[model samples]
Target: MTGGPATPPTPRPPLGPELEVRRLGRFDYARARDLQQELVAQRAAGEVCDQLLLLEHPEVVTLGRRTPEGAADGLDLPLVEIERGGEATWHGPGQLVAYPLFLLPLGRRDLHAYLRDLEEVVLRTLADLGVEGERREGLTGVWAGGHKVCSIGVAVRRWVTWHGLALNVSNDLAGFERFRPCGLEPGVMGRVADLAEVPADDPLLEAHLERHVRGVFGHR
Candidate 1:
């Protein structure tokens, strides 16, 4: 291979940032929360490196830390209170949920920037799937054609972040129609299947998202 002038390689995130990924097909909400609690403690105590949990819940609605009053008044699903900061969102089959039990980057402990990074991951993933995903002003999740395809509600404890992002691949949208997520109007959620011609298998998408996230964070 010959070149007139060699192009400089692109700079990547610092390597060797340990990341553990767990993919449980269709897991429980409460149990996953408990597992996150355990991992957070372990991570803070130096017992574990950065960890990422990827799974889909069986139709559950989580009330975020900033969710408004009566946000989920009449939902027929279990209402779980979590430490994440955002409004309510739904998790169910066909969506990809990722919780990164990570140690915030040294000297750059900015939560807002981290949230934007999460959005970039989802957007890139969508791009790889032949879909164009963008960000909406005054919103935290990734959007496509003015509809939300991914929802992010993050919470940090001792600079260790948890409660990550969820991307809709092919989930049943009826659940989202039941509530106003993030104080946004109802019926504004979307899925990758809606925009892509490829198959929206959860496991396949989960694997792809994991790869995208690993590269985005540059965790070894």
Candidate 2:
């Protein structure tokens, strides 16, 4: 069964203002999670404003709250169990990952709205790249045509958010072959590389996305 109980949104604690943006160029999966925990605590303690971590992680498969019954039965690559609100998804090179450890807006901690806002960042980002990104109603991530170009899964603590999105910019997407992505069957995914204009490589791509997210979420 899917994890996560229906919890009411709480008012955001009065903390330091302004969302801090950090780009970790290239990092491993475990390291990213470690930093998220540290930052989450800081946000909860009012020692820091909201933080947005933009980086790319090495090949890894992450399980979300609704992961299928036997999804993790077998896997050769690294598998991580997270508190996010989705099914299984993968992360690796060429995928832009954003971890927004944000203090939820006061009285606006509605999870569904927050999710749509996250998709807005990517949808706008894709539009800037000359690609048509659309959202499939009843589904979370941004889709171009019918293919999913982005995947979003998030977890919250103390009314603060962690874990964000993974956009397929230039990766081979081999990591997705492991399971039914977001509970969907295989071969339904799309990559930015498939577009005529490939996004800037690595560190550059991270910065490009960072701008759009900040703008969408009011950090700009």
Candidate 3:
């Protein structure tokens, strides 16, 4: 008897440049920012491939380009002023932060498109974990169950991108109460663990994220 029609081979994700994925557990915010700067320079010089640094930070509040002066004046958390495009935001132990040090080619250099691709990567990863994520109109993050679950802020230098999105895994949401995050009310922040059972440092979640990044950003 003839066998049933064979299934088509799984189509591979489209490839662009190579990406090196690194996992740095509980890194300091300042150090991480410095590292991104160093990598950006190297990537721009054609001395390194694309890089995706995934990690968590201790309790900290960061001010972006849109943050007004003194926006974080009273926050007890460590405050950092950064060059990324966004407002004030928080990062802590239970959050997963990703910094993509990529030297964008001519085709992928559109800042708006890059932001959307980052959102798409998060949406796909959340779907894999059984959570539905959507983008709000005029907002640049992933929300679920009517609350913001991801915050994205990025900067590009010499066409190289750095500083990226933060996903709340099992992080302490209470920290958000001390200050406005992403220019939204503190109550707007949400955690993935609230909707599903996943650790902040889950390896499987990181793997899913890597796959999504590769697919969405066209990195091999």
On TM-score, the candidate that comes out on top is: 3
Q: Output the better candidate (1/2) by lDDT.
A: 1
Model 2 agreement with the true structure over 1-220: per-residue lDDT tens digits: 1222122244333323487888786799998999999999999998988898988888889999899778967888889988888999988887888898988767567677678777877877777778888777577888785688899998889989999899888777667876899988768788887874764453336666777777666664
Residue pairs clashing in model 2 are none
Error of 1 at 22 (Å): 0.8
What are the lDDT figures for the candidates, one per model?
Answer: 0.79, 0.78, 0.83
Error of 1 at 150 (Å): 0.2
TM-score of 2: 0.88
Candidate 1 regions with alpha-carbon error over 4 angstroms: 1-15, 199-204
Ranking by TM-score: 3, 1, 2
Alpha-carbon RMSD of each model: 6.7, 4.5, 8.3
What overall lDDT, based on C-alpha atoms, would model 1 receive against the true structure? 0.79
lDDT by residue (28-146, candidate 3, tens digit) is: 99999999999999999989899999999988899999997777787777888899999999999878899998887765666777777788888898898799988776788889988
